[model samples]
Target: MDDLDLRLIKLTQDGIELVPEPFKKIARELNISEEEVINRINTLIEHGIVRRFGASIGHRALGILFNAMCVWNVPDHRVEEVGAIMAGFDEVSHCYERLRSPDWEYNLYAMVHARTREECERIAHEISLATGISDYTILFSEKEFKKTGVRI
Candidate 1:
């Protein structure tokens, strides 16, 4: 990565401008062509310097008040199949498979967001019904301590 690439990263680390041509805007700022800006970003991604380049929505700002961490005690053999189903739900923003111990047998987790706790529960129920995995718990988030992407 060159200086221009560094500048491009710094410019877009927070977010790209909400313009009709965000890349063109960045190109102007970087004194490079729009294609170069896009190519640099693509190279960064291909090289795994940027694992993801996507939107980050603010659920609270959108009136999605309840965020629940739903944990499921999925059978060891079906963890992948069950996790895919859980991740497919629209309400679930994040799904993960975690190592469990004797103290905590829940191996699968998903973060579900909704306007209310009841909605969260309903979504959880829908997930349970879809996956046929009812041995689970939903822990609502009481507070948000941090919500930001990694800084370069």
Candidate 2:
């Protein structure tokens, strides 16, 4: 709600360092007390500016070599049910419902990961079967251009 709160949100958008007393380090750099930084973050969340704060681990470091964006043509009536089922899977890291496209009419989107390409395909097939949606597509990432957090 104040300038300090805005600065805290901006700095935190870049992701926090995974170190002991990370907030203390941030406070030192901002010339504020650690408690102030923590309180401000809480306030920001209460204001709906911060959806959630957490760490994102690199999938490669966990031996997850395969990742793909799986899109599904879920019926409008069943979108929520299908999305919840897809998101509940451990392989799915992210899931969302978007507007249907011309080339691809899928509204349900999910990110899947596995150890190999075949594994990824199998998971996609399973999702299709589970959702009872035969029409789907998998767009695998050839290379990662950027994965860093955004700064607002």
Candidate 3:
């Protein structure tokens, strides 16, 4: 990655403009051709510097209001297996394995989103049934804060 690559990433950290020629706009700002702008981004991705280049949806704006943090007490021996199983669900947007504390017994966590609380519960139930891990808890979010991705 060169200075131009850094500038390109910084310019797009928020998002590309919703225009027919978003890359063209970016290229104009960076004083480069549109093709060079695209090629640079592609090369960054190919080299693994940029893991993903995609859109971030506003789920709440789309009526996906209910969000639940479903935590599971997965066994140490089966953490990876259970995590993968939970992550496989379409309802789950994020899944992770965290270190458990003395007070907190849950190790696996999954973020499930839905249009309703009942749907979120249903998804959690389906995950429980699929994983055969009944010991779990679902915590719903009362409000959402500003969500942003990492900046360059």
| C-alpha TM-scores of all predictions | 0.79, 0.83, 0.89
In candidate 3, position 45 carries an lDDT of 95
Q: Write the per-residue lDDT of candidate 3 for residues 1-152, one digit (tens) a residue.
A: 88999999999989888988889889999999999999999999999999889987989899999999999998899998999998899999999999999999999999999999999999999999999999999999997675776777
Residue 88 of model 1: what lDDT?
90
lDDT of 1 by residue, 13-123 (tens): 999988888899889988889999999999999989888788877889999999999999999999989999988998898999999999999999999999999999999
Ten-residue region with minimum lDDT total, candidate 3: 143-152
Error of 2 at 110 (Å): 0.9
TM-score of 1: 0.79
**Which one wins by TM-score: 2 or 3?**
3
Q: Give the TM-score of candidate 2.
A: 0.83
Please identify which of the two predictions, 1 or 3, would achieve the higher lDDT against the true structure.
3
Q: Model 2: clashing residue pairs?
A: none
Q: What's the lDDT for all of these models?
A: 0.92, 0.86, 0.93
Error of 3 at 50 (Å): 2.7
* Model 2 per-residue lDDT tens digits across residues 1-152: 77877778777777788788889878988899999899888888888887777776788999998889998888899988999889888999889999877876778899999999999999999988888988898999899988775566
Provide the lowest-lDDT 10-residue window in model 1: 50-59
